[model samples]
Every structure is written in structure tokens, then in C-alpha cells.
Target: MKKQNSLFARKPAKSPKSKASMDYPETLEIIGLSHEARGIAKHNGKTIFVTGALTGETVRYEISKKHRRFDEAECVEVITPSPNRVEPFCQYYGQCGGCDLQHLEHSEQIKAKESLVLDQLQRLGKFNPESTTPPLSGSDQEYRRSCRIGINQLMRDGTPIIGFRRRGSSKLLQVDNCPILINPINKILGKLKAVLSEADSCKEITHAELSMGDQQGAMTLRIKKPLPESLSSSLQKLAEDNEFRLYFDNGQQINAFGDEADLSYQLEKSETQIGFKPGDFIQVNASVNTQMINRAMDWLDLKDNDRVLDLFSGVGNFSLPLATKAGSVIGVEGVEDMVQRAQNNAKQAGLNNCEFYRADLSKDLKALPWYKQGFSKILIDPPRTGALEVIKQLEQHQCDQILYVSCNPSALARDGAELIRQGYKASKFCVMDMFPHTSHVESLVLFEK
Candidate 1:
């Protein structure tokens, strides 16, 4: 026979079986969105979840995962695009997991989120609000003040990818810049990448985090070990050059180096500034967060004589504001550090009316000192899992009004069901686009006893 190439190239082998199966694309009509923002389609009685496909659009999709009752797909072609669809601004739109609804119109995205909240409340909570207020929304882009980015130590052409994980995969995609971040953050990415690349300790970095306060920004390098002298000096110079607070977390403790110590975000409505460390949890979208907090306060209709209780309160974001209007505000948080920070913030603001106590809200509250306090109104801003145990004891407190802020609709619905059972009726509901291009739904509901 004629000379054959190496064994690997001996034959132009057939495509892998899984690849071949996915190569056969199917046309699908998207009708709804899954909880993860994937488009939902029905094909031959099997439900297909499609990424990059908008509702009311027909698209050609390739199967990525096939299960017994459902299949997962990635949209290949938009055969019929929805009117609400628009070209994505980011070049890495479909690939980056940071944003999912960038292709959909911003207005439509908020509407869809509002619809999702209402639908979940109806289905899971078996309750509906008496009225749905207009959604609180702001700029569709460049609104995030807090962000986290992953760093891939694996070298590609002697350079690592610094950005976010790819959609449905652990692989990292290198992004020059992210549009959702504020202008200051975007301005530093190029310089930040260069600094990381040149640093000898770059390979040890697991991720980078940034949070912008009103005057300054903080960046943290989560590393596997302490950086060498040379790398630390380089990072310090980079922070000084870019006017950012930089830190290195070597698993045990974090060491800061830069002029970022006075970092605080001011709540204009209440005129209170909340200080936080590099890794503390805070709201991402400043505008939406302020508006939402103001809305909650308005809904509570605080009076000088009304005592307010804030549950799951973080650094007095809502409690400090509530203290300005209510007789006294008692904030309960699960994290002791956060509770201490909230107390300090209240003290700094010269607001002696607000007090914070640490309590594991996810656990039983029967023995907690604040558990017995009867407040005229209450506010709860729970995490994704919601506050089931806290809601269960609401009947014992007998608060007249309660405003619940939730980032997950399903969790809110489950908690809402319990609230209704405890003799509370949903009154006003509001949704906000806290995360512009993502399916994250931030909703607030007011319940009256």
C-alpha cells in the first residue's frame, strides 16, 4: 500500500458518536424560559432547554445533553427572531456565563422577570398580590459596582485566561473587558491583566474580586500561597498606579496594600455610609439597590413611633435607613462580623436609634433576645434559600406590616405560602432589574397582617 501517515492520521476517522448525534440540528419554537434563563421548547413531547434562544423565537439548536424526559441544546441559528431580541453588546455574550439575557431587549427582560415573579408566586405560594407596582429599573449596562472574575492558571501561549467561566462548562474565556462593570472597573482590566501576567505569583491566583465604593475601588487576589517579594512589589505598584486597593488572600488571612482603607458606599436617601472589607457581601447594582431600599422604606410607611425589625440585614443597608424614620430599628443578621459592622456603621452615622444583633436566622429563633420584641413593622432581605424558619414565627411577633426582599422567586414563593398561612395577605409587589443582563429576579412584596 502507499505510505500511510502516522497511526492517528492513518484514516480520516468518523466524527465522535456524541458529536455526530449533536450535528443533526433541530428547529425549535421557544415558548418560555427555564429557571436558569434557558429557552424552553417542546419537541415530540420532549421538553428541550435551549440556550441563546429567546421566547417567541424559532431557532435551530444542537443537543448538548440528552436526558430521559428533557434535552439541553445550544441555539445554532435564529430562524425567526423575536421582536424583543436584540444584538448582544458583549462579544462573549453566548459564551460567557456572566450574562444570559443580553440578547433580549432590556425592557422585555424586566417584564419577563416580573412575569416570572408573579407566576412563581401563583404556582408555588398559591397567593397573588393585590397590585403589582411598576418595576424599579435603571441603566441597562455598566451598573455593577461589585463583581467576581475567575483566573485560569493554565497557560495558553504563555498567557492565562482571566474572566468568567464559560456557559455550562468550567472552561475560562479570556475577556479584554466586561461592559456590565462600571467605567472605572473596565478602565483597569487591561492594566490589571498585564500586572497579573507579569507577576511571578500569577499562577497561584485562583480568582480576583472587585467592589467599587463611591470614591475608591477594592481588588483582591485570592491566591494559593503568599506572593514572593518581587510579585508583591509589582502588585503594590499596580495598585498605586491604578488607584485601587489591592489585597492578597493566602487562604489563612488577607493582607491589604494600597490607599483603599476608607471604602464605603453611601445611601443617599438616608445619608448613611456603610463600610465593608474586601470580601464582604454587598449589592452589585448601586442605583437599583438604593431605589429598592427607598421603596421598602416607603412601603413600610415608617412613623416616628413605629419600631422596625430588619431580618437578615447586611451592614445596616436597610436598618440604618429605617432608623432614620422609625422610633428604633433592631437589625438581626446571621453573620457576627456583619452585625458588628452594622453596629459600627450605625454608630458612625450618629444614629443611636439602630442596634444590630447577630443571630443565625436559618436556625431556631425562640431563644434569641430580639425574638420577643414586638415591632410595628418588619423588613426581611433573605438570601436565595429564603427565611422559612423566620416566617414560621411571624405569627408570634404580630407585626402589622412586613416587606420581604428576595433575589429568588421560587424561594420567595415558598416563603410567601407560609406568610399567607400565618394570616398575612400580599398587598403590593415590585420587581427590580438589579442584575440587568441576567435572569436574577429581585422582587419585593409587602404583606399586611
Candidate 2:
């Protein structure tokens, strides 16, 4: 067994006499940002990481978590604020973990994200992209079309909190409205709180997912216990009054109501619309997502003879669009439901050239039928873990070009190194503001042999 190091052990709380010996409310000058977007500083020869601090700013912060070589602190006052600093519009900005960069100017946030991606690529992959494309951007506020709000214990005043988790904690922070959510979704939070807090099913619901399309909104409740019929009827009425769809999921079954309209969004470039269930994995920022797909098509420079493969394809977000130019497109997803949904979406879009398949992409796919097929272009949009196994076989499949839509820079870098080893050179790279005011960075890269 490995022994715990003493240097990193927690220090006991100080007694009255030794309270003066403690280091807190310490003044520090931030020099950089950590991967989590926290400000980095050095004080007393030991590194200190400060939350809510920006680069080149001096802040007064108190230690929140102690460590061996570094300590974590929360900014109490910004004695010297950066010129890029701006007032956060969200009332719960500091407490909510959903939006970390809300205090920074939106333009500055883009610059920081570009730097972060470049740093990760150089440090982890040891290579620079041939060229950097201008970032794809969109509205900074009220852009989130989908969000999952936590339902946890009520406050001392007996009001339940329905919002995001607090920073670095499991506690839920009650929010009346979120500035980042679309207006339609934000408008429903108050009524949702009122109905949910007073319902007998209040404690039974673990969380609620809110999603909105261009024309309609939907909410899904993940309930641990069966809701009373009366309460379910009330929720249905609430959905009808607000012109939204509602669904409830107990441990065993799901019930839905007021689903007159297909919860869907249109891809203007392809003239295709995609329908998704409440729990499907649709991109939260619709405006940026459309731009991203358009950018992906441009970067791929698709030819009519092209045969493309879309890996980790979710509900045909990219497949149907790629089919617009490619001769044939194959979309592979891990989840069976998503595979079915993708096929349905492609069929609805009148895209006969596209097909969907369910496969576990994390494992070897050398013998798979799709693996045997030759692809002129490939698009991968894996989760944070990335598509290492799939990239490892790209050379064997004789793929000519590869485009990656990355949500995690580190994972992209790791997989990029593998692609480089397979004789692929990154030709273009660009960042996307898919998630504004958050540390999350979305990037796109194009590679060719």
C-alpha cells in the first residue's frame, strides 16, 4: 500500500493564540490561468490558485483548501482589477459552478480560450497546428437551449432549491433565473419552482432537465418515486399553460404530455431539421452549433465523391449535414437509442445516402464492417475521453482527412499525438464559443495525410 505524504496533510484549525500565525486574506498578484480557469499566483515561494481572479490582477483572497506545494483560495476583493474585468450579469455567478468566466469580458474570454488550446496542444502533443482559423462565436447571453437543474434539500426557510451545484460542492444554489439560459427556458424557472416546491413529489424528484427548440420547450423530471396522478396532472397543466412539453421518469417508466410539436432544431445550411427527445445529447448553444456545423463542412471541403464517417455521432447532428455533399456517410454511435434516432433523423431529412450504426468506439474496430469501408473524410466528436481507439485504426482504414470537434483540449492533444504518429498533420485549428462564460473550450481541428 502507498503511504500518504505528510506534506499534503490537512493542517488543524488554529487556536486563539496561534490564529495570528495563519495565512489568509493574503494579497497576491495573478500571473496566469490554471486549466480550470482559476488564476495562478506565487506567494511565499509557494504557488497559490485563486478563484475569481484574472491574469495580471492583484486580489485579496482567503485560503479555502490547503495543499502541500500549492493552496486554493477564494477572491474576497479585487484590490487591482484587470482592464478586461467586467461585471457579471448573473446574480449567482460567484456561487454557481456553471459559468466560471462570467467576470471576464467576453472578448478576453475568447483570447484566453485560444491560449489555453494552444498551450495544451504544445505541451501535450508537442506540435503546433499549421494554421489557426478565426474562432466561431455567437451571443454571449441567453444562448443555452438546454440545462439540467439539480433538485436537492430545501433551505431552512422550507423552500426547495432548483439550480446548479455550488462551486466545488454538492450543495445546490437556488436561482430565480439564469442569464445564460434562453428566454423561454428562463421564464419557466419561477413557475417550475413554485409548482415543484409545493408538490407532494418534490422530494421524489432528483433533478429536472430543461430543453428548448426553436419553436417549443420540454422538461423531463427524473423521479425516484412515482408521482401522484394529481401532481402529474398539475405538472401537465403547467406545461400546457406555458406552451411546453413535460415528461416524468420514475425508476421503471417514463410518461409524457403536451408533445404536440416535435422538439427539434433546423440546420439552415443543409435545410434539415433534427428531432430529439428531452434527454438526448443536443448541443446547448443552438446558434453556435449551427455555425460549428457550417464551419465543419467548410473545413472538410467536401467533394461529391467523398465517403465520410461520423464517429460518436449524436442524433445525426453532423451526419445529415455531411450527407448534403458527401456521396455516402456513415454515422456510428455508442448508444442504441441514439443510433435509432440518427437513422430516423436522416430518413426524415430525405438523406438516403446516410446510414447509422451502433458500436462501442472505445474498443478495437479493425474487423467491423464500417472499418473495412474506405472513407475519404472522417469527423469525430467524442466526449472528453476522446476517440483514441478509433484514431489508432485510421491509418489501417486508409482515411485521407480527419476533422475533430473537441470539448476537451487535453484529450484532443493526446489523440492528436496518436494521429501524428499515424502520419497525419493538423492543417487547421479553430475555437468555438459553444459555451460562453464557462471554462469549457470547444475546438475544431482538420488533419490530412
Candidate 3:
């Protein structure tokens, strides 16, 4: 037998098990919760993530996915439940992928999200806020103003199945009602499903987006191809009966069925009504959106002489409000259509001081015409990717204040560190419960130079 070299020697190999055998049910002691709201546990010295398991609870779980470093599990039975665990009110809570933290109590859900933000800041950015404000939250249920309902035809029967996706799967979960949606949207779900099930061309639809504004509602159906005249008329009749605007989108352009007023939401504090088309991006939670805008305004401490720059501005959500208080406001957006919409919104709001510009924010913005004007304060509401590029250019602007609105905590933490490196100090940080019972963390950070 050849002598083994200790330097390159392999340890005694353990018996290999098949995938099915490796997934045998195992008991674990939940130790913590991940940023995604899954419970953390240890099995054979490896980390296991258990869904539907609360921290500090003993649970029986089965591995759903095995990875090299960690394993993902689905909680099969709760040996002991945490005090913070609560009964999810929605009938389709476990099945629907729309919500992740419904099993966790509402208040505890907020706490977990708050903790997630702070943890990400420390772990990724290696920085902490000077101070944190109390979390801003609204009603836990019936708070969602907009939602996209997935549509698919049942394999067994040709009937339409409507609702969100099943958890961790591409399959559709038939949900006639969702508790998180506002009453109006929930009330129409069953009726809409019934109508679609009866229509011969319902299979042409991929999904339907429902949006509710303060005064009106709109529904947009995404179709693979044009619907027949009969199907179009039936959908229009349904929209009329439901008192909502109806539109069909066939990959290229959106076409309205009947003449209905545009959808608009009220920002009572600023006395502004923002009108948007059905496909336009709007906050899903209306109340939380209002509160978030109010908080942003207060945190920025706008002054009559201040010139505000709102980056990633969408439909003048913050620009119009800032314009109402600042000397002059310049809104820059990447999408030309959104810039036009923002301009129209400003014009309709009768705010002559507000101007909207179209620019690619990811690239160096120094050459932009609006950059030469300079701003005393800047508000950034970039998408989930965060505003690292914008944060890098802030030192050149020499703005006194920078208010960042983030929907993704990891991205926020990364950019927050960049701001600190530029000599700005994080003054106030607060988590917003814009999406309750979900792992999504929305937050505001005020950085003062």
C-alpha cells in the first residue's frame, strides 16, 4: 500500500446518501431569524434555514433544498412555538407567496424588519446610525392599494385560476380573496375570477394588475395576444359593472377599453393629487406611502431658500411635495415617459417652480444640465439596487442634506457606507412598514454633511 502524504491526505470518507435519504425529517432548535424571515437552525454543524419556524422555537423540519454551505427546510411540525407566533388571518397564508411573515405576529414582524435593516448596515457597511427613530407603520391588513394577480388555466379543467404564486413554486395558488388587499380589490377578485372562467379567451391573459387610487380604480390585463371582440366587450362590461377603468396590454402598447378618468391619489399634507396611468409604478400601501412622504419632508427640513434635487423621481411623488416648500425643485428621472408625467403632474398641480428632467442616473451626472444648477438638498429614491453611483457624486454637489429612501436593506447598507466615506454622517434612520408581513424592508436615512 502506498503511504499517504499527510499534507494532501483526505480524511476517511463517510457513507454517501441519496438526495431523498438526506432529506429525512430532522429536529432542530431555532436560534434566530434571517433577513428573509426564515428561522435559523443548525444540523450536523451546518446552517439550516427553516421556513415557518420562529426564533427560539423547537421544530421538526424537512430539507427542501440542499446546498453546499447551507440547507433550506420547510417546517413540518412545531415542537414548541415562540410567543411571537400568531395565527395568520388569511385563508391562503401558507400557500400564497405574496406574504412571508404572516406566521409571525404583526408587531413582531415590524421589529424583525427593523432589526434586519440595522443588521445589514453593520454586517455589510460596517457602520451604524447615530440614532434611530421609532418605526413608522400603518394598518397590518387591508392596507395594500395595488396588486398583480397571476392568471393561469387549471390543468385538470380549463377553468381560470387566479391569485398569487404558490410559495417557492411557479404554480399558481387559487386565492379568491386576500386579506392584505384593500376591501375594494378583494371584493372584486371572486367576481373577476368568475368572469374569466366563463370567457373563452381567458387563457390569452397572463396576469392582471389591479390598482386603487383615492377616487378611482384601474385594472390592466396583460395578454399574449389581442382578445377577440366578444372577449374585449365582456371585459369592458365587467370593468363598467365594477366601476373601474379597464385596459389591455399586448406586450407593445396599452389600449383602453372605455373612457374613464385617470387614477389619482391624494397627498393631503401637500394638497396634491398625483394622477397616474394603470401601468405606472405607485406604492402598494397608500397610507404608508403618505406617511413616508410626510416623514421625508420633515426629515429634510425644507426651507424657502432651499433648492431641492429629487433623483429617480417618479411621477413627482416627492418633487411636487418638495416644490411646495422649497425655493425651486428639479426632478431627474431615467424614463422619458416618467419625466413627461412628472412635468404634467407639476403643471397640473400649478407648481411653476418644479422642473422635471430625463437623465441616466447610473452614469456620471456632472454633464447633466440640471447638475450645473446645484442643489442645497438632495432626495434619492432609487430602485432596489440602491444609489451607490449617486452617493459617489454627492461630495461634488456639496449638498447640506441627503435623504435616501431604500426598499432593499443590503443595497442601502452598501451605499450608506459610501456616503460615510464621503464625510457625511447618518443622522436619522427609521424603518417603514410599507410592506407588512413581508421580509421587504423600506427605510429612510438622513445624511447631513
Candidate 4:
């Protein structure tokens, strides 16, 4: 047999199942942010990933590794805030790890975010005319109508765990009230913390999904240990105490959790009700979502008979609202649960004109059945990866108007280039500050085909 290569020998035959837990560098400074999710700090001309840090705040972190270009570090402290800092509302502000920009002024956060978006558009689209650029700023706080939290086991103790991932990895972060989540969810943080603190069997938790339903909020705990027989009682107490349903994961939990929990959201400027589940992906800032949808619709200039397509549609956020104006609105999503929720929400809102389909839009989207139709307006809301293939599909449909909502600038730029390749001009770009105190930016771009 041939000898194994040194590189192959050093590497595992198979990828490690578990992610590496890392400590941020013990010492670091708040340098800046690319958008908002990541923090930038350089040490001795090296870079570090400082988990749990804000710009201008001197902090301590543990170094994860050293690369030829930069080092990765996770946050451990928040020494000081920049002059533009503000107090955080959520009790779980730091520990929850859901909202990092809570410490900065929400308005200032928008200005910074707008700068980032404009910078990216110029860099990628290479546009400079003011006619194609519009000043974009809108609601900057209390925008999260939907959010997700990881549910996992506690440490050595039996503590039940629920909340966002740690600063840098899958490790669960201990959290209380989330600053950016709905008041209904944030209100239950303390009770949740206390409950999990008492669960001795909680040791190897993974993820928790928090969702806002049509009338209330729901919490799903993904625990590593077997749920106790008193799971209902514990959850009942928690719900009574916090006014939100408690859901347990594992093979036995499907009904017990769903039957007890229901989440809801009030549509902006309307009485439309949206129901969501723990696993459903909703916008973190409900308020901003409304503005975003409004802006996208405005940019698309939907006519009464226009057909609109919303890719990566979650909970019918844009699709539901857009349906109110357009002749027909179609939403495409990857998660079936979210698709169902969107459909249910449409039914509840009495919105028959809106439809949702579930399919993976990340890869080749040509196989999707609903994708056969051409659209007058296309709204793409993709994750950090942005909508590359989806953009291609839109090109295939010969869409004339495109509104792109992006959270990642680099990916947005890449996809923007693809749109340019397809003869779409970046007509207007603006930024929405969904996150404050952190270097994150939410951007909206309108392109003409």
C-alpha cells in the first residue's frame, strides 16, 4: 500500500464532528467592524476575533489562532465604550449574544451602516452618480420580531441551557433578556435563566429557536439530557412566570411543545397577524423589517397587476405585505416550517394573493417548480452568502426590477456584480441600522434590469 501523505496523516480521515471551542485573545481593542457581525482588532499587525466586544471598547479576549495575516480572538470583556455608546435594555445584553449593537446609539448605528453599504456599492458596482444613490435610513431599534437561540446542555451541572451561541462558536452563551427581541420574549429571560440554572441534567445542549407567533412568543429548548417527567410542570411554571410557552426538544417533545406554545406578530400599519414557531426564522428587528419591506416595495414600484417574487422569504415578512399591493406575490424559502408558517400567516391575514413554496435557493434553483414564471419585481433577501444562483434565475426570468436586502456586504457585492453581468444597473442603495453599538450594517439596494 502507498504511504499516506503527511498532510493527510496530520488531518483527520474525516472532519471532526465537533467545532473547536476557542478563547479570544486575553487583550484586545475595539478596532472596527466589517458590517456588524464581526469585530476587527489588530495585535502587532496581526488580527484577532474578539467575541463579545464593541468598537472603542477596550476588552480582554482569548486568542484562538494565529494566521499569516491575522489572529482570531473572542471577546471576554468590554472595558470602555466609545463616546457614542448607550445603555442596553435587554438584561441578557452581553450573555445572550443575539444583539451586539445594543450599546451604541441606534441612530448613529444607522449612519455608520449606511456608510458601509455605500462603500460596498461603490467598490463593487463602481457607481458614483447621486441620481442612482438615495439616502437610506429608517427605524433603528426594537426591530427584531423573530429570532433564534441555540438550545443545549449546561456545563458539568444539570443546568438546562437555552439561548444564543457564544461569541465565536456553537458554545451556548448564558443569556437573560434580549435587547433586540420582542418585549414578550425579553420579559421571560430571567425566569428562563433561573429555570435552566436548576436543571441538573442539562449538560450538552445545542440550540434553541425563539419565534414570535401571531399573538404570543414561543421558546424551544434543545437539551442534551432527557427531559424530566415534570417537563410540563416546569414549563407551565415558566410560562406562567414569564408569559411565554416553554418547548422541549428530543424525540418526545414534538406535540408537548407545539400544543403549548404559540407566537404572533402585528403587521406594520395593519391588523395582519403572523404566527410563528420556534424553528421559524423571523427578522430580528420586527420594526426594521416593516420599513425594509416598505422600502423594497417602493423601489420595485409594484403595479396593481405586477407579479413579485420574494426569494428566501421567511415568515412572509415581505411577501405578506407586498401581497397587499401587488396583484400576486410568491415567496420561496428553504425551510418547510417557515414556508408553512408563511402560508398560515397569509391565511390568518386573509391574504389569498400571497403564496409560499419551500426549496433550497442556495444551489441550482432551476429545478424549483414555481421558478418557471417570469416576475415583474424580484426581491432577494439572502444570508451572508447572498443570492448568486437566485440572481441567475431572476436573469433567466428577465426580471426588470430588483430589490436586494443584504446583511453581508462582501457577498452582496459579489451578487451585485452578477446582476451587473445580467444587464441590471445598481440604481439606488441605502443602509438601515438594524444593529447598534456593533459594526453591523443592513443594506437595501434597488437595481434596474
Candidate 3, TM-score vs. the true structure? Answer: 0.93
Error of 2 at 26 (Å): 3.9
For model 4, residues 151-254, the per-residue Cα lDDT tens digits are: 56634655666567754356777666555556766666546666656655544445555566556666666665656756556755776566567676774544
Model 3 ranges with Cα > 4 A deviation = 1-25
Tell me how candidate 4 scores on lDDT. Answer: 0.67
Give the per-residue lDDT of model 1 (tens digit) for 1-449: 22111111111123234534554435778999877788999866788888778898887656666779887777767778788877778887777878888888999998888988899999988999999999999998899987888887665555766888876668888888888999877766666678777755477778888778888777788988777888777877766565577888877777786455567999865568988878778998899988998898889888999989899988888888889889999999888888889999999999999888888887888887777768899898999898988888777887899899999999999999998998899999999899998988899999998
What overall lDDT goes with each candidate model? 0.82, 0.83, 0.84, 0.67
In the range 1-449, model 3's lDDT, one tens digit per residue, is 22111111122124255434775445689998998888999867889887888888887655666679997777767778788777778888777788888878899988888888899999998888999999889999999988999999976778888888987779999998888889878877878887776676478899998898887788889999888887787777777676677898888888787786468888965668888887788888888888898899899889999999999998999999899889999999998888888899899889999988988888988877789888899999999988888779878888999999999999999999999998888899999999998888899999998
Worst 10 residues of 1 by lDDT: 3-12
C-alpha TM-scores of all predictions: 0.92, 0.92, 0.93, 0.75
Off by over 4 Å in 1: 1-25, 258-260
TM-score attained by model 2 = 0.92
Error of 2 at 48 (Å): 1.4
- Report the error of model 3 at residue 43, Å: 3.6
User: 3 or 4, which is superior by TM-score?
Assistant: 3
Write down the lDDT that model 2 would get.
0.83
TM-score of 1: 0.92
Q: Which residue segments of model 2 deviate by more than 4 Å?
A: 1-25, 153-158, 258-261
Q: Each candidate's root-mean-square deviation in Å?
A: 6.3, 5.9, 7.8, 9.4
